[model samples]
Target: MSKIIDTAHVFFFVVGLEVRQEFAHGALRDTSRARLAVIAGVASVALPALVYVLVVGAAGAEGIEGWGAVVGTDTAFMLGALAIVGPRLSGQLRVFLLTLTVVDDFLAVSIIGIFYSEEIRIVPLLVALACLLALWLLGRSRQWSAAPYVLIVLGLWLATLSSGVHASLAGMIAGLLIPAYPTRRHKVVAARQLFRDFWQSPSASSARAVGRGLSRGVSVNERLHEYLRLPTALLAVPIFALANAGVDLRGGLLVDSLGSPVTWGVVAGLVLGKLLGIGLATLLAVRLGAGRLPEGVGMGSVFGGAALSGIGFTVSLLIIGLAFGTTSDLGRQATLGVFVAMVLACVLGWAIFKVAARRWGEETADLPMTLEPPVDPEVDHIRGPEDAQLTLVEFVDFECPFCAHATGSWEDLHERFGDDLRYVVRHLPHHPHGPIAARAAEAAANQGMFWPWLDFVFTRQHALERDNLVDYAVELGLDVETFTEDLDSAEVAKRVERDAASAADSGAHATPTFFVEGCRLLGSYDARTLTAMLESSRRGTRTQEIPA
Candidate 1:
């Protein structure tokens, strides 16, 4: 099973490489091409997402049992592959593909949060917001060390995971915020000299010239670029695949599960929807004057690549895990769907690329120059000892399904424990709502109605857009004028940033993370598990009071 998972990882890497190469070639030459690719990716993602929203919402499965089968594209596995392959093909093409993939990731994350999530915990969301601010602020002037920023990034992932947002959303958010340019003058000088050499002698030695440019002096931003392009993409993604994709398929049960409606839905959505969405969107982009044909590539090649977008492996599988419980028929079906889609995508994508390569002669272009920006660390605040005892620490995001679950659980705790529990909220913003949601949470906190606002979020986690957050504040009878302004205020942003940093330092990478009396738990929990822990903590507290 592990071997099969590993093979699947390699398979995805290849698929990602092919798709990226296609996008990169298009992106460098024409902005329209990149835009089209983005459109196709989003269109493909929307197919499943829409299905989830409509079917699940109508069925009232918006609760824990229902939203378990929502499917999404795995951006990291796909885009990370592009990053690893580097801009070696055509620089313009690579840029186009990279940008498209980045946008794809961002959109997918947003959909998960805004439409699919459950509830928000104000404190955790605030914490996540603070972290985002810190990352932006510390890295804003581009004066921070890469180590602290890296730690901050990881911490955000952990806290976001704990907070109830998809942990992967943290990865994307952090990636976007982390600068990717030369920070030092010496590095810039060396890079320019190397670029000059490449332009001067195109035929002399491309590989050596590029290597020299990459090896130029160290910049925190450049190092970050390397981290994203290399370890995160090539190593972490593949390892994650090996861990997550291995399913025991030998059982006849596995085969039978694939025949179910849920499986069909996932498979059809990924396979059929991807092709239709991507292909149609590409055509529309061209018609709308948003995209154009690449110099050598034609509509046929685009269609073929569009078909490849059908390969919804990682993200699809993850959604399956969340939308469908692991033990259910839905999960089994989703797993099969992912495998079928990947296989189909790989074959079709390869065929299309082969034809395009032969016909167009595969002539590549060079990468465009990118200006380096300053990088920062989004860190959480340190907790005091008194705040530690009986402290209910929750790291969460406003837009996260699991966070919603945690929010539900926390509400239960707050009701049951009442004043006994001192809640400490931390931000672990993930995906579409990370930064935006955090800001909203902070704004609500400013009005002294943070708890009620959190309850409102839990009730409408799926509706955490900027407008929705503002509306929520209004519904809560807050000073809408002040609340709206606070949502974007630097002070609020900073407070959220502080909490986010605290979450990172605490090693949270998933949404709805909890530390009850120093015991940590990740992901959502049932009432029984949480009650048991609370009971245990209560017992311990009582025993300590007995003066042992």
Candidate 2:
């Protein structure tokens, strides 16, 4: 039963990891905040260990072995609790906590591998290393098929198990090696071409070909994550809980655990230690110019989140089993401590958020919802009639494949609404050449050719380097010398910056985010869905104007 639980936990953990997306969206996007998060995460773990050592004076190996139980934050439970009881708008705060927890999980797993593994077996270790190399080679080959990767990862897990290293480590290592990349425009185009062929022929062979093309367009990491996320969350985790969480408290064990130093040490380490460690670290980091809080997430909100971070349920339980045998008295005591800490953490977090809301008025936890610096015809790049009743504003990046694909959606809306709709595009430079491409568009706007420049660049998203921009200028019939000079001009740069600043202020983080009549559109932005939403909004406007 234990071995089965361990295997399932490892498999789900690997499937749940979205390494590239997590770093790109959470940490790398905000370096200073990520640094602060790392510091806070370290402090959150380190301070608890220190607390345990202090509480359990003359720390014996047995007493110290339990330190790993305090190192991880249960990401699923913590996030769910926040959604239910946290501030109403918690998007940015959620991102911040997620970044911190990623570092927390990494450290916990590393500690398990370093401190808890049994005697090393060299032969099996070599086999594990070879399996890892094979997985790496498969990733580098850019193969979309999932079977080879799955088989290699299974071999890796088996080898690691035989090597006396925790097989869970194999899952983490294999997940990290899997290649992840942005959806390429060329691949998307190729997939669409395949679909067109299927549409014309309509046979099983053609249908299978379309399926293969569609799968090939997406990376294996993304495909696996998408398909595995639900099962990992709803099925595997619950099974793990059932197998590991049953504790027999009938033999005076509950009463004995209440007085145990190990029990109190685990509780104190999580509840009090996480609060002070994370809260103080964040304050010190900001004071030392390390990083500011996510916009609208005040210091008080950080404290609340810090309190919630103490709910280290899953990983803590896993570590407890690793540190002490399942039948040990100390294991039961540690489990009791975890339950206590969870309850205490929840109460503390709720109290903090309630106090912060009433006392500090720091209620909001996400970026602002309304459009900042509302669209102005004189300054914004507007299409269709300036006085059109319906307005669609898009924050776009030229180098973003999604934004390029959204060109069809934009055109569809334009064709449908024609004179009744106005479309505005704003710069949100998220890719490598995003800023430069935006600047080129602005320079074209200087010569009254913004729309044409936009059309040309969106179609050529695969190439947006400096040379490409220059070529686009020549193709658009602009004076090459003037266009080139304007491309680097401070005025053009400022124009793009203005749009970017507006995007940030309006809570647009990703490319191709849209707003309809000043309200940020949520969910899918396909043409059909957007059309329905627009019509609904238009009717609502008419109803309001009828003088209710």
> Once superposed on the true structure, which residue ranges of model 1 sit more than 4 Å away at CA?
1-34, 48-71, 76-95, 115-120, 182-219, 249-251, 292-298, 358-548
Clashing pairs in 2: none
- lDDT tens readout by residue for model 1, 1-548: 23323333333333333333343322333566656767766776666555544544454432223222333455444444322322224333333334444555556656557655566456666666677677778666755366777666556544565566555555555555554442343454577688777887775586576665655455454555544444444565566677665666656757675545555556556666666776777778888998764443455555554555565666566556556655566576567767876776666655655665667644223311111111111223222233333555667786665553333666676667766666656777765877888888778777777767766776676677888888888788999999989988999988877766655555454566666554454333555566666677777842111000
lDDT of 2 by residue, 1-548 (tens): 45543554355345335644555343345777768878888888888777776665554425667888887777766776787678887877777786677677767777877887567899999999999899889988888988898788778777877787655556666776777776676788888999999999999999998998898888888787777776665765566556666677879999988888888888888888888888999999999998877776888989999999989877788788878965789888988888889889989999999999999997877777779989999999998999998988999999887772345898788778898898899999988999999999999999999998888788888898899899988888999999999999999999999999999899888877888888777656778877877887778841111100
Q: Which window of 10 residues has the lowest lDDT sum in candidate 1?
A: 367-376
Whose TM-score is greatest here? Answer: 2
